[model samples]
Target: GGPRTQLEYRYVGYAPQTVEVGNRTMIDVSLEQETNELESVVVVGYGEQKKATLTGAVATIDMQDIKTPSPNLSNSLQGKIAGVISVQSSGEPGYDNSTFTIRGIGSFVNTSSNAPLIIVDGVQREDVNSFNTGIFNNIDPEDISSISLLKDASATAVYGAKGANGVLIITTKRGVTGQPRLTIKVESGVTNFTKTPELLNGVDYMTLYNEARRNAGQSETYSPRDILLTRSGLDPYMYPNVDWIDEVYKSFSSVTNAHLNVTGGSEKVRYYVSASFYDQEGQYKVKKMNGYNPNLSYRRYDFR
Candidate 1:
């Protein structure tokens, strides 16, 4: 008969509600606190703030999403975060950390780097791309609570010129209001190249060389007898066709990571302590005797 009316109410911290006013003289409504994801806390360049209140671009990642078996935390950031490009140049055991660029490349100089500013627990770190003195790779992924990327002008505003490139904030887990909780994780895995390069063996390499010489109207470097000898792989001292790849490198290597962390405390004094162990073997090998270890390996232990 009459046009129906409706009322909607919403607030920043409270849930939104919609009510219809039909054939009712009086209506009572109760509003409860809203659990908005925008209200979740995130670490910024200087401090922490709610995502809803942030002016610049900020991206956060869940700890569960980055729980990878990789020894370097940067390796797990690939494909997980937006505007973040991670390029892993090598799979070397201890030097496998990915090169990170937020949004895009931050530098044009060859000597300078394009890595984002890495801050751990409010302390500024030198460089994430350091292969010799790498501090970022040393950080255990288990101890990290959250990682936030300040990806725009807000990044520059927070830390001045240093943040011009981008800011990668890593917040470690702190004590919470509860009993002492112990977390132990032991993971073992095998690391390997996704696709091993197929190289031409001695026979193929020699034959190809001879073919190229004939095409160029030049004398063949390898003769038919040489090709046959190489194919037969006889008398390595004379007609040697060695598979250097197989001799110097293995098919795959093993990796082991173990973490032990404890978090607990009252409202007054909170505490979070952790110890982590990481062992990664290189995909390299050499001749050895006397039970000697001629294998390249990297081992690290962290206490925080």
Candidate 2:
């Protein structure tokens, strides 16, 4: 026989005990428990549903697999999702928005409308075609909690006209009923050309050209001695055995990203705030007359 007090804690473990005393009672408690997978909620066209009950063709992206440093979410989604094809057309600093397709090309009549609709926090955004660069640059990757892609018609039918291509639902992180927590993440890396074309040098070019001329029943413009001089690396100014690929392209470029996030609150009201900074230096090297070399670079700061 004893007095007992019961308390409820969310996402936490607890131990209960009973105590008894003459006319007065007190219960000492200790906590130790682990939480496991709960039901997952997914957002669809106009409402939300449990992932287990959803009948549409949907795929959830695992944020853990997106380890590459990218300026936009599109770049990180490359090859990470099923039936999605992402192509980065250009490596230009801020303009590096990747072109992505859901399933496959739907129609050739209107190539411009092939892009999927982007919905952030249940609001439809403007078509990305209107923006010259990646419209998602303002979004910090750390702030994203989950990304749900709706592919089939039954899944995207709610949008009516805009549902022809598909739909991409982006969900941001929200504070939970817990102690205030702060997280800081920093990443830095380098980018370089994976492969470059192998072009013929000046001597090889001259030899090939002379061979072609001889095949056409014409005299060889470059003599064997001339070819030897070009191959021997003598008087480059005159022979001009230039490797244009090396002259134009750089070996590598640098990239850096940093993010800070704070989240916490009570069950009634929660808050999440984040700030991020990203910088990427392009591989293009421009030579200036005054002994200066400038490389294309991009810097962006984001707050949410």
TM-score, one value per model: 0.76, 0.75
The global C-alpha lDDT for each of the candidates, from Candidate 1 onward, is 0.80, 0.76
Q: How many backbone clashes does candidate 2 have?
A: 0
Which parts of model 2 are misplaced by more than 4 Å?
Answer: 1-38, 108-110, 128-133, 228-234, 287-294
Q: Where does candidate 1 clash, by residue pair? A: none
Model 1 lDDT per residue over 56-152, tens place: 7888898998887887788988888898777777766677777767655445321225667788888988766665536888888788889998888
In model 2, what is the error at residue 80, expressed in angstroms?
A: 2.9
> Candidate 1: where are CA atoms >4 Å away?
1-35, 105-114, 130-133, 211-228, 231-234, 288-295
Against the true structure, candidate 1 reaches a TM-score of: 0.76
In terms of lDDT, the poorest run of 10 residues in model 1 is 103-112
**Residue 264, model 1, lDDT:** 94
